[model samples]
Target: MTVSRVTLLLGLLLPLSAHAAEFDGAALGAVWALPFAGMLLSIALWPLIAPHVWHMHYGKITAVWALAFLLPFAGRFGLATAGAGVVHALLAEYLPFIILLTALYTVAGGIVIRGNLHGSPRTNTTLLAIGTALASVMGTTGASMLMIRPLLRANDNRRHRTHVVVFFIFLVSNVGGSLTPLGDPPLFLGFLQGVGFFWTAEHLWAKTVFMSVALLAIFYAIDRYWYAKEDLLPVDPTPDTPAFGVDGRGNIALMLAISGCVLMSGLWQPGIAWDVFGTKVALPQLARDLALLAIAGASLQFTPRALHAANQFSWAPLKEVAKLFLGIFATIIPVIAMLRAGADGPFAAVVDLVTSPTGEPLPAMYFWATGVLSAFLDNAPTYLVFFNLAGGDAQHLMTALAPVLVGISAGSVFMGAMTYIGNAPNLMVATIALNAGVKMPAFFGYLAWSCAVLLPLFAVVTWVWMR
Candidate 1:
């Protein structure tokens, strides 16, 4: 790693020495969550109501939300305490989250699938099915980035292109990532917390398959309806061309390397870790992240410029994720801490809703609670909240409390499709689609799509699997 790399890594993994204090969640009121709520609302509304302002000043807007929480937090607690909370959030939560996402985004951006099949209903569904299969192997973002351009190009000639991107976000970016920890951050956090590597695959395979098939079927039906209503443009935007094959296949090895690195981190616990402030940074985890960064860099260096050019690879998508998530991480500290505090915290009613009076776990409620929250908040942290709510014991969660785990896991991963901000890839996919000239829905419009389509399907999911 170069000096710049080291500096960047250190900035992310900032030592918690100066601010080792913890937040007093019990003392904190519900008001503390305002900044987080504001951040999410801004993300949801600004693009629809004020696209120019959002596009230009989103980072500034994010900072405003972060400060809303931070300034008050520092005043109520000491600056050290507030700063410590921030550091811990960065170290334990955001750092690994963003690093791995960045690596995946970067590596996947280098690989391009070249081909333009006519955007027939069958062809689109087949592409979605293929992307769905690839999601668990390469991640939702990876699969979406790799396949979205072609899917878009295949359908560029058609009208009513918005629904295709919407379904694409639902299947390729969210539901398809349910089967493996590598597929989504929540599952990866589960793996790091001692859930087995194949645990998610073994448990969520049925749910993943059910959702994928149902969504594909629904998409086909809807797409066929749209295909029938298709109005041709004066000039066809994308003329059907000769068959195209996979280009930059070399990045496949790099993605596998990243996956292997994650598995190794989970399995190879050598008891080596650094005490960065109050947090213990483990060697295997650190090694995995470093290896991922190197792998991403290598993929970029080795891939031909022509391939990247073809893919229209740019840092804007990653930059959007990085900026927006910083505000989320900062502002969410209080909300998550309050949730962690459970009964005494302001969200006691929320906690009450998820459990029975007899203190037994309610799998159905857990599903909706986790899923609903994940739809608005980042799913990974939302998963962590409910994981702890369900007793955070990996061994028991894997065995006796299995249903609850499945509920939390399913809700967090599956419901990330309800809106663009629900998952990292959702926003990224929407952004890419918009850049590609698909008139993607605004936040509430997208929610209308999910609410109309996904909620009924999730009811079936709850009845079949979670219930």
Candidate 2:
């Protein structure tokens, strides 16, 4: 929002766009994907291998990758083409995505849940369930920010509680957000791309419910086993208060207002759009973005400072997301164009993998392809790639090819639990746990837990639903 920040955003993002030039993916080779590949690899590997360096210089690291793509792209295609792509990605995709997230984070961070409950197996399960349901409403980032501290406080007395945080990531951070755009970034990208606001809830609710219930049951059983092990601290770190309640409850109404803005944008298009660098910025989208910023400002103005202190609220997570995704949205421009090219593009093998020999689409393969990629890469752009690959027609995807959309949506949202880097909140929750003195697992250790638990369940989902 500051001038320097705007300059930095434009400086990094300027390489991705081309003025009025629709990129032909069939003309591009696989080498164009390296910057994107490097960006993702840095995100996945850096924190694990060099935590201090990553923490200190992640913005510089992202800038390096963005330049890596943009410099070459400008030289090869001319500056105008590169410039247009940057504006398009920024105004069309990045601004809206980051604005909504900022609003959600700001508003949710204002609401502070007070007091703590004992972390019994039943109590922990109930808390996870509540957080899971809230994920679809407040967003994984917002819901995770609101709920994790209370959950951690509840289990501060339990000596063996790493599994508690792990299951929280599985349910509240990933799987539970499948039913709505507010629940996850991938679904939100789908919404911005003309997918109906309610389409995901209608199609993916069954899967969401099935996954939520099963994960809750599994969490209860595991938590009970851990509870029975008699791992208890002699003195509870956080004593239970006589009263339990919420502060800054007014944000609840603001959250609904935010949801209304999104829903209205989808339903009430005025067909008036301004052409900015060849991208059509519609009036509805413009109004929605402005309203979100205003709502975020209102939260900051009215929410009490005491509530913020109680929540341990900070803007670091939101800032990190904005910076990292700046590089991601920039470098991903070509990969998306190539995927859009289908069989004629360099990623023809990808096309073949998701389609059958007879040219029939296979939802099971789509599920696995999107899931596997999402598990390693950032799920939002990964969702965009596959959504575009599936013909980039929201109406058609929601109707005739509904099963394929289901596969892509479920995979991106659900299997993000497969790794810490798969979704933003997974790492945020881990960091919060670590700060609270819970010895959260290293990246691979968490991966082992997810594979043991979620992969098998996903296999069953494929057989019963996707197939």
Candidate 3:
């Protein structure tokens, strides 16, 4: 993590000046991906097998996998390639990703919703709809953190509510983020890769609206069935207030600033750049990241202390994200590289799966493949891999390859609901729900819910849209 350590690792592990970009993924075998696989396995199995060890040393576990990949990588392919990759992952990819998330998390957590209404099936579904709409504005994490406690408060009296939280993940955490880059990490990555700021909203609007409307409708029917089964024994724990409204509204300005900064970075092209190690830091992007940090700081100063208290805002969730993603970003570098290498790389079979024999992009295959991998792996980089495989040209993807891009976008965002680990926000929402006294399902148990409800809806989506 230290500069000197990085210097030594890069200097000795790989050839001097050799960057990951110079490393030919085609020359590397599937064995190079073991560390990434190990990292995924660590995230998936550790918590289930040893809760104490995983909880305490998850960072260390992730670090081990990262080192596993880095040390061997340096030894095999020197600076000519891997150096570019290592620097890019850190400076360009990981740093910006984490910063934006932190900024959104900090500001959104300050805006708490107060005075919850009773949790009727209609009310719950309506709240889901609103949160889904809000996700594009606030980012999924912001909206989820803001609305989740009120949702918990509303449903505290209900005998059965896990189903409500499950649908919340489907709609708010995943599908809701489809319209904008700020809404989800994957889309934001596309923004960084030169996609237009509103490109996702432009091309993905239909699918986003479709999924949001359909999911809301399904949630309503299901919640009605579950609500009918609840008895009168459980009393609502939330203290009734005169009316429903929101507090910490000042954060709205900060949220808009966040969105504006993203848009400006895309629109204002100053073509200037800085060389930091092997990564090319563009002037506009640098300015945008600085502005984001300033906005987060301003939000902290401007928002009242009472708002943070009301929200019960804490740094624990963000810290958890920081620790886990360090390992993820590091280990995933090669996987992304190899994936970008296309049919010549170790994942050739995977490449072949999403392509027709005549070499056309199968939008449906792209959807399922991207979605399923994203369900288990980190959705953001998984999206990048497929994005590159489909040709990493933002202009081309947005125009000529629009359908393929849609399939990729819908898959990465929508199927993140399939598992708690699919998207970062899914687990956070589940955790907040649990802390608020909801008996959330176990890992696999939650997957059952997704398989039963969300998958069928996704099938419908693929049929109507992707096909």
- How well does candidate 3 match the true structure in TM-score terms? 0.94
Q: Ranking by TM-score, best first?
A: 2, 3, 1
RMSD, each candidate, Å? Answer: 3.3, 2.1, 2.3
- Evaluated at residue 58, the lDDT of candidate 2 is 96
- Residue-level lDDT of model 2, residues 86-105, one tens digit each, is 77888888999999999999
Candidate 1 Cα misplacement greater than 4 A, ranges: 1-19, 228-236, 239-243
Q: Tens digit of lDDT per residue, candidate 3, span 6-109?
A: 66765654455443446676777888788878887787788789989998888778778888887677667654455666777877877788889989998998
Model 1 score (lDDT): 0.84
* Residue range 317-353, candidate 1, lDDT tens digits: 7788777877887788888778778888898888899
lDDT of each: 0.84, 0.91, 0.84
Candidate 1 at residue 66, lDDT? 80
- Pick out the ten consecutive residues of candidate 1 with the lowest summed lDDT: 1-10
